[model samples]
Target: MERPRYESPVERAIREAQERGEFDNLPGAGKPLDLGDTSDPMWWVRRLAEREQLDFTGALPPAVALRKEAATFPESLTALRTEESVRAVLEDYNLRVRRDRLRPPDPRMPQLLAPTVDVENLLARWRELRAAAGPPLAEPSAPEPRRRRRWFRRR
Candidate 1:
């Protein structure tokens, strides 16, 4: 007859928890795993990012990351307060795109080259959004001077 195996404390605790239904009805209990169509080697990293609500762009190639940023550039400009700041942001982005273009393509993702952004076009869009938002509300004027209390009555 085969000898019965001894259960460790940790294993016993886990078994007791399972018997108590502590592990049932948890999130994604019976759902099929969502491994994407292609068998990406970094599937676990992607899954961890999604589960933790993390931005996974930093893991992408520079060109691909820049392309993604460019796609959302207009929305990003909405938070800037002045044309100068907007121009500076676009110029910096264009500089980075130009620099990235000079670098040798990433062997793994050679097809993901990003083009430089058209600063003028983006600036026009920013202006349009700003105009549509209407002028900034004027600041309230200085409060009226407080009246002084008359301690002595005039005779």
Candidate 2:
């Protein structure tokens, strides 16, 4: 990575270009390039997401995604329809967490990002969310019983 005392062809071309003012007044002139996380294999992908300001968590493994979702459990519960739906979602989430726990950890990657969820706490949060969502749909009222002949009415 040393600069040559004698001009190499690549250096000669660069020098010629500089003489022609090709590198002058360039965008971000004199600024360091953001060669971020060069050691990471997915550096470019990470850079793209950072540049675009995207929510990249969903792109992570199910365990990681579930952990993130669990962090915002109450907010997430609002999207579900019923208590049963919430339970089902948690069951699926827990199953994935268990699977991740059982799997051998990768040397290159960090440990499983999944966290265990207490069903009761999750359900309590679900109930709170459902209550905050306003009243549930009610069934129709029962029909009133028909009355027999009364004194005020004709027999």
Candidate 3:
């Protein structure tokens, strides 16, 4: 014979609420749960990322993150207004890549390697993009200095 389970006060309150229809018509009611195909061990992590609007790349290994950044480097450079800024960005990226390469490889991800990028090639591509986009629009001239009205004649 099995003993009846005792319900705590909190549980009793919740059960009473359910019986009173208070729990009905809640969000996602009657909808099938979206527990994705369970093949992936990290499915929960992915789900949490999606739900929280996280950047999945941030969770990647350093080498993988560097590779992803390299792949998207050109597109990212489109926002920079100066060749100097572009150069700085590329140099920083290269420095990080070199640093990552020097670190002892992680046994779990030994094959993940991020190679240094060609700064000259990326700069050339940036120049081409800037030229194709045409010169940046000139900044609007400072509004004529607003003149303050004199409350009284200076005589």
Highest-lDDT candidate: 3
Q: How many clashes in each structure?
A: 0, 0, 0
TM-score rank order: 3, 1, 2
Q: What pairs collide in candidate 3?
A: none
Model 1's TM-score against the true structure = 0.67
lDDT of 3 by residue, 59-106 (tens): 789998998899997778998888899999999999998888788877
For candidate 3, the lDDT comes to 0.87
List ranges where model 1 is wrong by over 4 Å.
1-5, 18-46, 107-111, 137-155
Q: What is the clash tally of candidate 3?
A: 0
lDDT of 2 by residue, 6-77 (tens): 988987998789889998999999999989779999999889888999887766876777777778876777
After TM-score superposition, what is the CA distance of residue 149 in candidate 1 from its true location, in Å? 29
The regions of model 3 sitting more than 4 angstroms off are 1-7, 139-155
Tell me how far the alpha carbon of residue 130 in candidate 1 is from the true structure, in angstroms, after superposition: 0.6
lDDT of 1 at 11: 81
Better of 2 and 3 by TM-score: 3
In candidate 2, stretches whose alpha carbon ends up further than 4 angstroms from where it belongs are 1-47, 51-55, 58-62, 137-155
Lowest-sum lDDT 10-residue window in model 1 = 104-113
